[model samples]
Target: MASAFELTRNMTIGQYIPTDSAVHRFDPRFKLVAFGVLVLAIAFCNTYVGNLFALAFCLALFPLIRIPVGYGVSGIKPAVPFIIIIALLQFFFSGSIAPGGTLHFEYGVIRITGDSIRLVIVSAMRFVEVIFLSSVLTFSTSTTDLTRGMECLLSPLEKVKFPVHAFALVLTIAIRFVPTFAMEMEKLMKAQASRGAEFGSGEWWRIIRRTKDMFPLIIPLFNLALTRAEDLILAMESRGYVPGEERSVYTRYRSKGADWGLLGISLALAAVILWLP
Candidate 1:
């Protein structure tokens, strides 16, 4: 039962893996922009070959960043079921097929067509590409760097009276709390298991029972999150923190030649992929 907690160890989307590699050393602002471009390219990809190219580009980043391929892919494990479900739904009901297209299966009004199958495949590829690219960014960058990057990237919005710092702070806090909450959930699960609560006992009604049982977990998790948030607020207040106040950054980010080269490559890749026929 304790081994179940180990599963959360691979949930690496919000966790940072520290390494000394060019990807890790790149300015976070440039990385953010490049990642945004990659995501757009993936989303707008129209052909199977284009999606495959996008996926290969994402996969190549793992070695370039010195992160293990397994670690880069681990984040997608937990999302497999959801991805499959979405793919199935799209396949069955997307209506992408033209009239008189080949039908693979049919039951009443539900039908699967070759075009729908292609759509699902492309959609799944897009999902994997986006998730993997995001994992690459998070794994390579620390929370502090991410916050600073976001702040700098959005600084231009301050000219319009936007609360840039506050917004960035909130985003950073939200991301920073992901692993904390995962740990908290693991602890809660272990505690409940000690009290003889059986979760997923392989019984037929196990799914239903587990669903109902989750309410107990949900309430406590919410309370714990709120408590943590309150503590953080108090700590910040005691330290003379004020929202939307000017603060001096301890570290400055400078874009190097390598960073510019990486950004240029990313832009060129995006343009080429988007231009694919």
Candidate 2:
């Protein structure tokens, strides 16, 4: 249980790291736009060379933001099994191999071809690139900045009667609760374990039993979440935070020349990746 708690605590998603680096100092709005463009570019990349460039770009951001490469890379470890499953499905079942292509292997109904292999490789690279790039964004930006930046970016939608501020608040609260809930789960698991509830005990039958046993943890966690939500509502109401009312931020973000330069460079790199032959 302690090991489980430590593992959950080490997860970096939805958590921010403070650093005095240019990437961390950049305006969140700019970072949001740049990240969107980079993700789109990565998604569209099909060739090995383009994917290599995308991978290189993602790796380079770690040092720029003063984050350890291993730490950034560890963020993808949790998804590796899923990624491998998807890649294998794509490789064996995609049916994308060119006519008359060299076949690598074949079974009763499954086939492996050069084109399928290439597609799987590129898809895997894209998955890693997207996940690591997103991790960089969350690692460098704080929850407040993310909320404000999203609100500012979505403010233009207010002309169409959209509740931009409310949407931003909800998004922010939801993201902020991710780590909180993870910790809560860890605590609940520890408490249960103290009562002789074994988890991941390595016996197949015990593992199956533990799976059923965990269902009891869900109701308590949900109730705890609801309690927290109520507390937040009361706190906000006590502070006179009315929805749709004009409110000023304590720290206003202003874009500088450096911000623009960074955006420009990101855009240029995205263009180059898209235009690569």
Candidate 3:
């Protein structure tokens, strides 16, 4: 396919879709905390029922947040191949260390067992849930909101002279540039194709050829990323931005009762999920 490098369509991580839903109206700080709690819960959960419940809970947020189910999950398109590889790897290789799963198949260096299969499926489910939940967060929150929320949440560390604002700024910028970089890569791929360079001609499952084809993109992509970062630095400097300087808040966020209620619900949900078998 000629659209191998068309990453923006599959990248929903940094893309924001504005909506007036209650979830969007909630304080970003609360949202971040709740998201973190849910992430930890998802990471700790290993049972099928637990993961399914988590997945369902995350999916339920789509309607609540006014994000189309299809659009919310579009990001999974590009990740499917990698997920398949990981699932295959775990299914084939993990049986060797599994304690007592029923054996399904065996070969000299390959084996399949109930435990291995469960591991693969559970891992994939976790990946999907995390990705979808993340998409929900970024889709609702703007870049400035994310940065401000993170800084506010981490402000306690400033007592230890931690650079909370700087760290938040760096993290936010990194997240916000994901879509930007994807589009830039797409442009570069088109440019190279215009110059008679071959790309995306190999079959998707042909890992070796695909990898080889992508080799030419790494250096130029990195160079362009750096240039973009430099441009950002110059722009910030031009605007008199100073890291670690005391800055006045242009907008102060006060948590509402609904924000607290949502946070409590998140904590409760996490506890319930973690308690699941």
Best by TM-score: 3
Model 3 compared with the native: what TM-score?
0.93
- Number of colliding residue pairs in model 2: 0
Q: lDDT per residue, candidate 1, 89-134, as tens digits?
A: 8888876568778888888767889888888899999999988887
What is the alpha-carbon lDDT of model 2 when measured against the actual structure? 0.84
TM-score to native of every candidate shown = 0.89, 0.84, 0.93
Local accuracy by lDDT, each model: 0.82, 0.84, 0.89
Off by over 4 Å in 3: 2-5, 96-99
Tens-digit per-residue lDDT, 135-204, candidate 3? 9999889999999999999999999999999999999999999899899889988988899888888778
TM-score-based ranking: 3, 1, 2
Candidate 2: regions farther than 4 A off: 1-3, 99-109, 203-217
Best by lDDT: 3
